[model samples]
Target chain A: MIALRIGLAALFLMIAVTVQTSVLTNVAVAGVTCDLTLIVVIALALSRGPEWGAIAGFMGGLLLDVVPPADHTAGRWALSLAIAGYIAGLIRRETSGSPVGPLGVALTVVLGTAVSFFIYSATGSLLHDPSVDWGEFGVRLGIAAGYDVVGAIVVIPLVMWIMGRVQPARERRRVAP
Target chain B: MLKDLGSPSRSTSSRSTAPRSAFRSAGEAPLRSAGTSRDVRRRRTVLLLVVLACFTLIVLDARRSAGSPVEPLREAAAGVFGPLESTATSARQPVDNLRDRFAEMDRLKAENEKLKKDNEDLTRELTTSDYARNRAQELDKLLKVAPAYTMTPARVIGIGSAQTFSHTVTIDAGTADGVHTDMTVLNGTGLVGRVVRTTQGTATVLLIGDRNSTVGGRLNASMALGFVSGRGEVGGTLDYKLIDPKARPKVGDRIVTWGSSGNAPYVPGVPIGVVTSVTANEGSLGSTATVKPYVDPTRIDTVGVVTGPPARAPRPQLTGKGN
Candidate 1:
């Protein structure tokens, strides 16, 4: 059952990455875009718990880094995402009766955005690109974060509903017998 | 049937066993001990993974030329989820189609009205003056000296995700259309970019304005040579040594490609841009200039790929005294 969930998550993650590359990128909102893959990672983390979330985040981030025409180092994304996942998982553990619905999603999206932007900023500073001005960084970060939050609000519930329906009831029956 | 045979004995043994409290205490002690160790180990593992990821990024980025082995893993992930991507795209196609239909109608109406007015204006202008004829003659002369390069038109399919550092565009032409790595791409007016990667039927072009993009260019009128490097924005900077500090380059001077060393990549004489501004510093030996690219990359629909040797080669050195 664990393997099945991982496989399903991986499949969805791939879809998210491809769509992000091909379609969602073209649909920009005020010169900013929603990172759909990030939304997927957060969703998986929330639904499947922490360990799986971190793994999914790492893989998804690597996929995003490799597919895009990026100027930064490769593993920058991998590390950022792993940290995001771990943090999200920890948050999940701490919150109680946290209505696993819209409120939960909003929190996850906001935190994920913050973590991604912070990691990128640190990495850029280290790289010494003179264009890494704080003002521009703040604006871009806000745009990305806003878009991601919107994506999470819309996508998380729909994914949860789908997973709930498709979950393998047969496994529970096998264990009982 | 095997479960049924063992079930009776299991129940009987449970009834005959020592009190539940005795077993419970023993179980609790070990469970608590094991849980703490497991938690510690898990935390250690997570920390180790984070450290490794950061270390790898730093080491790889410090290299003069770096490309990560993680690319294959990314590709594999994409391949695995290709089907889901298609489904999502298809799901959104209906709405897109509806929006496009209305937009197309509006565009056609505007185009028709503009064309009708243009025809009347052209007819009146042609009768009144020889301006069109003179312009055509000049254009003909220019064409003879430097013929327009061959082109393979392409449609932009995608743009880069991270807009902070560089700008990239993906086009619908690739190796199948005779496109190759590092081939110069140009729109009607000037250079656009070079092909970075190619699949069977699609290619990604790294735009000239991308932070990493650099091209050898020269001023058309003065023949002043310089290297044009992207400023991580809409414009590029010309870095060149001027023999005279007073060599003031005026605005609107054309910039053209100086070509490559051996011409395996870019062909020469492709228009790059026009000088928008120039600044000279007394402390510095050379001046810096800004270039406004002729092609508005945001609206580029069709582009030409220049193929062949560079227009000029390095001058050969005389062996002894001048003949």
Candidate 2:
């Protein structure tokens, strides 16, 4: 059963990455597109726990860092996403008694995105990546975080609902505070 | 689930043998809202291990200059996801075309009216300039702007951003199709980018708009050499800096490739863009200009990779257009 859950999470992440790279490329608003894979990892972390969150984040981020058209360093996304997932999972644990509301999810998504983008650019600059322009960092951060928060509202609940269907009935009841 | 959690026999025997078993016992607690101290310790350990692994990868990837150890991993990922991306792109293309058509309708109507007026003016100019001297000048302009090259055409399968800092596109061509790293990619309009990485079935083209991309270019009129670098936006103007400090670059000046040695990365005589504005250098030295590229890197659907440069230089044309 654990294997099945892990496999399902991996599959969901792959699909999210595929959709983000191929379909969402055309749907950019103001030259910024939301990070769908990051949201999926957050949703998985929120549904499961910190351990699963870190695992999924690492895997999804590795895929993002190495997938076709990937020109950046290999572990930048991995590091950012792992940290994001860990924090998000911690948030879930803290709010266990009360179901995390939509507003909370949106807020978490925004914070997670900003944190991850910060880590990515921070590491990028450290590595001397020429793409990290300091002048546009603030603007990119605002646009990316805002766009991801908007995407999270629609994506996070849907992922949790799908995960709930496959979960054992006892665990499902326990998960809902 | 209950057997793994409740069974004391399994946990006690395997607990000493493997840390993972201890993780399964404590970390996999499904029903417990509050985990034990052991569970928290195990979770922290897992986080630490994962973080350590990520840092290792980062250090390895960052230190490598050329021919990275991560190349095989990147290739494997591209091989696995390339077809999936292509499939998704094909499935989405029809819907995308419909949306584009709807969005293009109003813009096209205005353009059609303007084109008709421009066509009439051009027809009148064509008749008036139908002389031998004018014909030679037009032919010279064409020769100066264009040179023959063998190229392989490919369609863009995916676009990459958000995760990567650079703007790039995946084309459905690869080493199997003579696509390789550092090869120039262009469209009908002008230079698009250069191939940066390639898998068996797909190639990643780093678009000219990426801030990391810098191409050697020359002024078309005076042949002053310079470099054109991207401004990190999809439709942003390129920054052109003259190599010679005293070189004068005026607005509306055209630029072309100053071809790399062996023509590996960029070939000679490919049209780049036109100078939109000029900025004076801080000191009494080099000139700088903002150039609007002929190709819209964001909207490129089909592009050609230059396979080989022309065998010979362009010759003078004695024939007229009609003849």
Candidate 3:
């Protein structure tokens, strides 16, 4: 059962990473692209709990870091994903079913995006270019939040269904001769 | 009840052993059970490692102050995705072709009408005052100020991916076509940007209206100089410390590049934009004016890189100075 869960998580992470870097990036409305990988990590964390969530987030983030445009160093994404996963897991434990689960995922996505922007801007400021314009930053934040929320709505339920299939059956027993 | 009390110590010991047994079983459980706390811990550790990696990269990238090593990765990604982009572009080609046909037909009709009007205007000019002829001669002289600074035409290719910075655009001309870093890119009306990055056949231009873009410009009528800085949306703000607070810069006043020193980055007299609005703060020393850029960056299909003439040699110092 444990092995099966790990495999499922690994497979989901890979798909999320590939889709984010390739397809979702091209699906921008206005100038904002959806962060699909972030949504997947948050959804998984909310559904299956934190430990798995953090693991999935770490792997997803690592893959994103290594992918195209190679803007930042490797560890930046790793840390951000870990924090996002941990936060989502905490929210899951505190929330209940139905709308709350999806809501939690949405909130996690927003929080994760905010943290990313803040960290990236602070880094840019330290780097001296200081490209962070307050007005533009606020607009971009709203756009990113909107994209993530929409992504969460679609990804959460789909992920939940997949998780249901991978979950172990407690009632199954071994047959003896 | 008796059975329960009789095995109280045994029960407690068994209870303690239960968690240990569960932990041991977790190690051998099938994949479905992998969501256990132990595995979660491992994942969290990995996440931390990834974040740390990104942080290190940001720091190093900022410190280098030069081009990023990420270029190769960007190029590779562009290469892999190039085919997909081409396919998407191809799919829209038919619609584009139709649009082009309609546009060409409209342009031809406009030209026909313009020629008819020009013939009438020329007839009037011949019978009227000689002012039109004098104006033409002056225009010819004005156009002859620098005959050497011709233009090398190029096409727009792609835009940058990052949303925070939209001031950059990619062009098909590069060093091979005399497009160098800091070389000015212009359209028919005015300056667009300066080339920043270049490859064998491509270059990235930083537009004047980007938040990071700034240029030295002067009002054509007043010769009042100021530095124009981008406000990030579609316009730029001009700043000059010497300007008065109540300075009234009317709309439609042309602005032009105020050349830097001999090694100035941009050529002088390249039209930038017209003053759109002017406002003065009550206590501020200088007035602020908004200038709408001359070139519409979004619709730019073609551009030219200006390779201006070499600097003039300094005149020799006078040997016979007055005593």
> Which regions of candidate 1 deviate over 4 angstroms?
A29-31, A100-104, A124-135, A164-177, B1-40, B50-54, B57-150, B198-202, B234-245, B300-302, B307-323
Q: What is the lDDT of residue A112 in candidate 3?
A: 72
The CA lDDT at B249 in model 3 is 60
In model 2, which regions exceed 4 Å deviation? B1-35, B95-146, B312-323
Which tens-of-lDDT digit does each residue in A76-99 have in candidate 1?
A: 666677667766654543342142
- For the predicted complex of model 2, DockQ is 0.51
**On a 0 to 1 DockQ scale, where is model 3?**
0.22
Give per-residue CA lDDT, model 3, range B81-123, as digits (tens).
3333333333444664456666855754555345334433532
List clashing residue pairs in candidate 1: none
Better of 1 and 3 by TM-score: 1
What is the C-alpha local distance difference test score of each model? 0.60, 0.76, 0.57
Clashing pairs in 2: none
Give lDDT: candidate 1, residue B63: 66
Q: Kindly give the stretch of ten consecutive residues in candidate 2 chain A with the minimal lDDT sum.
A: A90-99
* Cα misplacement distance, residue B146 of candidate 3 (Å): 4.4
- Interface Cα RMSD in Å, per prediction: 9.9, 5.9, 8.2
lDDT of 3: 0.57
TM-score of each: 0.70, 0.82, 0.61
